[model samples]
Every structure is written in structure tokens, then in C-alpha cells.
Target: MQTAVLSSRSLRIALPLAAALTLVACAPMSTMYSQDSLPDAVKVPAGNKVVLQTVGVGEILYECRAKKDMPGQFEWTFVGPDAVLKDRSGMQVGRYYGPPATWESSDGSKVTGAQVAVAPAGTGNIPHQLVKANPATGMGAMTQTTYIQRVATKSGVAPADRCDMGSAGAKQKVGYQADYIFWKAS
Candidate 1:
């Protein structure tokens, strides 16, 4: 029987390389979006780090509210969001909501971003989009987010229910799923 030993030089180089590869594989991120295909206005500037990626599973809440144009009527108006952001492994990480979509990490870091561009999805599906985040709001994991891209959406829109949409104060909730990629200025 013969035994082989890895040289010190080889081991030094191979260990770190192997560890890096393992970490990358464990990250579980899929289909990283590149800047080349995104609109200039929505693109994240070069040198930003992709800090986190999650699946936002929740509702695009709507409320039956007054559509003042008509004499006496109401319509379903977008009311903000109610979602739980989860990791690729399906672990809950945080939440998303707001007038400007906000992503908050479990550690209290958060970023509020606005839609800048969209790529049309098929009929009955919502479009994917790039959102530009505002300046950091806190000193935590989420505070660094400078950009976000929502992709791989499954469902988001509420059904065209015949229920009287004009019923004031009536609320509706629809399930939605999308990939939320968070970027930070490095």
C-alpha cells in the first residue's frame, strides 16, 4: 500500500480555494442578475456587493376605498405590502413593506427602494424589476442596501373578483412570490 501526502505549498493554496468554493455553493443564490441587461437608470453602480438574496413571500394588500371621481363608489386601491422575506433555504430573514418598498434584515438593517425599471412578464403575471435604494437608514445588515432587483416572480395580482370592489373599507389579500436581491455599495 502507498500513502500520498499533499505538499505544504499545495495544501496552503488548496485549502482556502476549497473553502471559498464550498461557501459559494452553500450560498444558494441562483441566476444572479448582471448590469448589462438592466436599464441604465436602474443598474447598480459598479463595485457594489451583493449582500443578500431572498424570496419575498407575502401579499400585495388592497383595500376597497373611495374612488372620488364617481359620485358614490369605491375601488380596490393598492395598500402597501405584507410579506416575510426568506432565504434560499426557506429560513425567514426579514420583512418588506411601504410607500417605497423597504427590505429590512433580521439584524435591523433596512433600505427603502423605488421601482426604476421593469421587464414585462407573461399575461396574468407581474413584471420583474430593478429598484434603486435610498441612502442607508441604519447601521446594520440592511442599511447598506443600495439596489434591489425582484425576479422570478410566481404570482402577485389579486383575482378580478366580482365582489363589489366598491365596498368601502373592504380589504383583499393575494399571495405573491419573488426573488429580492439586495446590493450594497462596497
Candidate 2:
């Protein structure tokens, strides 16, 4: 009787442990951050791999101004962006801003990039974008970045308020969020 009881207890513990291990082993190899499902226009170029990822939470500033080359017409033009960059755990890791579109790490490293491509995200959301990074400054997480992809965007579109002559010179702030994936040459 004693031997049977011991065996039963051992089996109970071992069975769950084995099942957990099996489930872990069968889990997919890919991480949650894979760019494979993104639009082709926003994909990082071949030979590049993701080095860092962050969530940008902030607002975009738009200024009402006369439309270029369209006399007597006016519109709201993008002035710039101001956002705080945070890691997956929600820790503030850096900032993103400026007319030049700069990404700066908490460690003082930073990079500016030129727009490479953009794809429509959806109604009421900003477009997904790919940027070709310039050389880094100050050396850190941003140093090795060769490209940046903005994905999973939410609610960054321009304000719907009128931009006609009456609304000209007015500024509007629109909140938005996006996942920024930094890539480097493989």
C-alpha cells in the first residue's frame, strides 16, 4: 500500500512537468515582433535584421497653411512629431521627434532617417513607413541601425477641422501610436 501511494504521487508531479515541457518544445520559433506580415512597402530590405523595437506614443503637430502651388487654396501640413519611445515592458527608452525625423535612445545615441516608402495602414490610422537610416551619433543602440520600419499604427491622421482660409495658421495636435522596429545589416 505504501509503495503504491508513493508511485501515485510521483506520477502526478512528473506528468504535469512532462506535459509543460512538451508544450514549450512545440511552441513556434518566431517571436512576437517578426516583420514578415507587414506590407511589402514597409518591409526592411533584404540582409537586414531587427535589432531593437519600441512603441512610440505621442502626438503629431499639423499647421494650417497655403497649399503649395495652389493659389487661393489652403491645407493642414505636417509640422512635426513629438513622441516618447518605450520598450515592450513600458519602460521609457527614448524619444522621437523633429521635422527631420530623429530617433534618440536613452543612452544619447541617435539617428535621423530619410523616408524610403509608405503604405496605407487603414482608415483613421497613419501610414506604415520604412526609413533609410543615416549614420548614428554618440554610439549605442542607435549606432547599428540601418533602417527603421514604422508599423501597427493607430490614429495619427491629420485633424478633420477645416483648413480653409479661416482655419489657416491654426495648429492641431493629433495623438498616435506605432511600433518602431530598428534594423541593422545582417
Candidate 3:
């Protein structure tokens, strides 16, 4: 009778453990971040200039220009994923003060601009999960996470003559590239 009871208890535990292991093994892969399918030309618009490029998911690379005869230089700020201001040279400009913002314009000469924003993982169109297992026990589990980290912006003098701050500029467009990756936390 005691043996029967032990057998039953073991079966109960083993059945559930087996089911869990199977479920975890069958779980779909996580998709928090992935590569973008859009082409380079399509990603960047027609007239916008090119700028810096990054090597992670949601990374943005593009340029901007100001209208003709604009007065001051292009001045703008970027809010990275951590919600901090980043410099145009791709350096962390300042600490997180508040909701990030940027302001830019022409400085009398014709100039171009560019920017790149590294999107946090898990912001992709599809979702992803991580699977972990214990070889000794044959038990497993899965978790989902994201890995993106920045936001960016750029501004410059427009290619035209008459200064028009509101205008996107005559047929001017910017190009962008978003790269995706599953980065391991350091």
C-alpha cells in the first residue's frame, strides 16, 4: 500500500514536470527585436542627406537640411531610450533632465544634418522569448525582453533660398536604416 502511494505521488509529479518540459521546448522563439525588411533607398527619403550609422536594432541613420537664408545654426537635442539628451556627434550630451526635445536651424551657410536612434529591443513588429533549461533536471522556462537604447534627431540649412522653417524643403527627404539584434546583457 505504501509503495502504491509513493508510485502515485511520483507519477503525479513526473507527469506535470514532463508536460512543463515539453511545453517549454515547444514554446516559440521571442521576437523582441529583429531586422528591418525595408531597403536603404526606401528607408531614406529622396533628398535628405546621410549621416552616422549604428550596428543594432532600431538604429536610425539619416540627414536633414534647412531652408535658404536661414539665420541661426542648426541646434537640436535628442532623447535616447534612457530619456537623455544626445549630441549630434553621437555622444551622450547631457543627463536626463525631462522629456527630451531638440531645436535646429540654419546658420547662414548651407549645411546638412543626420541622426540615428537605437530602438529598444522588443519594439519590433514581432515579439520574442528566451528559453532557459536545466540539464540536470530537464526542466525549462522562457522569458521575453527588449534591447533597444536611444533616440536621435538632426537639422541643417535648407537647400533653397527663401527661409521656410515649417517646410520640409523642396522635395528634400531623409534616409534611415534600422538594424536589429539580440544583444546579450553585459
Candidate 3's residue-wise lDDT over 22-72, tens digit each? 776555434343234432322332332222122222221212335237564
Ordering by TM-score: 2, 1, 3
Candidate maximizing lDDT: 2
**Error in Å for residue 89 of model 1:** 1.5
Give candidates' CA RMSD values in order. Answer: 6.3, 6.2, 18.1
Per-candidate TM-score against the hidden true structure: 0.70, 0.82, 0.20
Q: Write the per-residue lDDT of candidate 2 for residues 2-77, one digit (tens) a residue.
A: 9999999999999999999877755432234676688888888789887788899999999999999999999889
Residue 63 error, candidate 3, Å: 42
Task: Name the lDDT of candidate 2.
Answer: 0.90
In model 1, which runs have C-alpha deviations exceeding 4 angstroms? Answer: 1-47, 66-74, 163-166
lDDT of each: 0.76, 0.90, 0.28
